[model samples]
Structure formats: structure tokens, C-alpha cells
Target: IISVGALAGMFTMMVTMIYSSSRLIYAIGRDGLLPRWFGHVKGHLPENALWTVVLIIAIMGGLVPLTQLVNLVNIGTLIAFALVSIGIIPLRRHQAFNNEGFKVPGYPVTPIISFLFCLLLMTQLSVETWIMSLIWFAFGLVIYFSYGIRHGHVAEKRIE
Candidate 1:
């Protein structure tokens, strides 16, 4: 029973990750940050992006050690959370004032605390994980500057 339950949970998490990653890839492709082939849709689904995600997952699963993969995911998630927590401050300040939406109870303090905690957690990750994450980020930066910046909708709007 315990083994079955664990398998089921793992399967569910795998499916969720695959779906979300595919959607992210599709969105980036649709926004011209990635090649258009990834944006292809069929039967109301981003089939190409889904397949791409599946292939990537399969390759990683086969080539990468599970512990390393887990660590990388942990660091990546922590970094994303930290960025969001820090980003909220600037976002709130830059946006037009509106009292109509949900507000953070402690405002800046809450977000600052959240960001600091995330940073602390990230520091606990292995150095290899940090190096991998930094390398991936650098690659993303290169792609964004070389192709996405010129091909994205924002660039088109700017030109017009």
C-alpha cells in the first residue's frame, strides 16, 4: 500500500511538472522568445511543446543523477520564489495605485522576509547546483539577447 501510494504521488507530480513546463515553453515560443516550432498547437494543445518537454525530461532522467536533478530543481524553485518576493516591491511601487486587489498584510516587510528566507535556503544547496543554475541562466540570457530581444512582440511594438 505504501509503495503504491508513493508511486501514484510520483506519477502525479511528474505529470504536473510536464504539463506546466510544456505550457511555459509554449508561452515563450508564442511570445517569440523561443523558436516558433515550439508554439505549434494541435487539438487545442501545445503538442510540440509537450513533446519537447517529455523528450527533455526523458533525456535528463537517463543522463542526470536523481539527487543532482532534485537539488537543481530545489535551487531553481528557491531562486524563483526569492525573485518574486523581491519583485513585488518594485511592482507595487511602479503600478498605479489601486485598493481593489488583495494586499500583502505586512507589505514590504513580509516580502523582504520571504526573499531573505529564500536566499538562506538557496545557500544551503550544493555548489554544483548553484553552478548548474548559473550556467542555465547565462544560456537563457544569451538566447534572450541574441534572438528574443529582436524577435519578441515587444521589439516589434518598439519598432512601430
Candidate 2:
């Protein structure tokens, strides 16, 4: 039963991650942050975006060892979560949006604790993982500045 549960959980995570990653690429392309080809659809599917994501994943999986991949994924997940937690503080401060449903109980305190915990966990990872994450982040920054910031829909709209 334990093995079965673990297998199910792993499959669920894999499927959800694939879907989410493909959609993210599609959204970015649609926003003009990436090549317009990435946003192209065929048969009601974001085929180009999905193919690009799959190819990237295949290359990464082929190049990196399984253990390193696990470490990278873990660090990436933690960092994303930490960013989300940190973002909530500023979002809560802004009164532009209506608060209709649930709100975080402790506001700043809760997010602060979460961010600290994520950082602590990140510190426990290997130096190689940290370096790799930083490199990827730098690459993202380069992409954003070189193409995303200028060609992005929001930026274009703001200019006009």
C-alpha cells in the first residue's frame, strides 16, 4: 500500500508539473515575452509551447544525473514557494483588490516565517545546487531584459 501510494503521488506530481510548465511557457509566449511561435496553437493545443517544454526537459534529463535533478527541482520549488510567500505581504498591503474569500491569518508574520524556513532549507543544499540555481536565475534575468521586458504585452501597453 505504501509503495502504491508513493507511485500514485509521483505520477500525479509529474502530470501536474508537465501541464503547469507547458501552460506557463504558452502564457509567456502569448504575452510576447518569448517568440510568437511558442504561442501558436494546433488542434486546440499549445503545440509549440508544449514541444519546447518537452525538448528542454529531455535535454536536461539527459545531461543531468537523477540525483542532481532532484536537488535542482527541490531548490527551485522551495525558492518559488518562498517568493510566493514574500509576495503575499506586499499584495496584502495594496488595497486595490477586494478581499472576498480567505485571508492569511497572521499576514506579514506568517509569510516571514515561511520565507525564513525556505531559506534555511535552501542553505542545507549543496553548493553546486546553489550555483546552478543562480545561473538559471541569471539566465532568466537576461531573457527578461533582452526580450521579455521590451516585447511583453504589459510593457507595450504601458508605452502606448
**What are the Cα lDDT values of the candidates?**
0.88, 0.86
Q: Backbone clashes per model, in order?
A: 0, 0
lDDT of 1 by residue, 1-160 (tens): 9999999987897898898999999999999999999899999999999999999889999999999988877887788899999988877775465645867779989999999999999889888998988998999999999999987777433311
In the range 1-160, model 2's lDDT, one tens digit per residue, is 9999999997897777777888888889998999788888889888998888788879998999978888988899999999999988877777776665759978779999999999999989999998998999999999999998898886533311
Steric clash pairs (candidate 1): none
Clashing residue pairs in candidate 2 are: none
What does the lDDT read for residue 151 in candidate 1? Answer: 78
What TM-score does structure 2 among the candidates reach? 0.88
Backbone clashes in candidate 2 total 0
Q: TM-score for each prediction? A: 0.85, 0.88
